[model samples]
Target: MKNIIEELFYGNIDTQARGFKKDSYLQKQIMIMSNSEEILTERLKGDDKKTFLSFVNASGIVLGESELDSFIVGFRLGARFIYDTFVDNITPYDDFLKEVNNEG
Candidate 1:
């Protein structure tokens, strides 16, 4: 098998291009959100509409950042699990904290 790092470096791994199955819960919710946005946008006008849109865009940015943070945390946790499995067992919180602090 080809190396994952090589594939990622060559732009072959597009993690951002995720998809949801048709008629799935996520798809249904996305449809509902889109419909709601269209309906609300039609009702809003002038400054109110612009303000609402700006708010929506800002909220989306915040949510995206939060999701990225969560993904990073989960990835780190998975790596930590693998480390614990194969490496020397260092399960104590104080020991972990000391090692982390020493790294910095």
Candidate 2:
């Protein structure tokens, strides 16, 4: 889990941080927030897609277009990583439904 989160953070940040000066605020914030599992988990929990969009839209008000765009790309990559991790850890949907049906 930690490896996946780290990979997601560094992978996106490496690409997104290009052309910006080293240690820029945007890059710094990405590093801090991405390293935080709690923040990522909360951002990725129930209704995550909607939550991500809401975050982007809200942040856009204060962020420039390029920064907002970078954020969108990073958010998408993070969301996918979180989703894949979740899918890999959980039972298959069909199997879960079958178990629930049997129990009722």
lDDT (0 to 1) per candidate: 0.90, 0.72
Stretches > 4 Å off in candidate 2: 1-63, 88-104
Question: Model 2 over residues 36-98: C-alpha lDDT tens digits?
Answer: 645665567678856775786677676777777887999899989989888765644558777
Each prediction's TM-score versus the true structure: 0.76, 0.26
lDDT of 1: 0.90
Candidate number of the best lDDT: 1
Best by TM-score: 1
Residues forming the 10-long window of minimal summed lDDT in candidate 1: 88-97
Clash count, one per candidate: 0, 0
Give candidate 2's root-mean-square deviation (CA, Å). Answer: 19.3
Model 1 TM-score (2 dp): 0.76
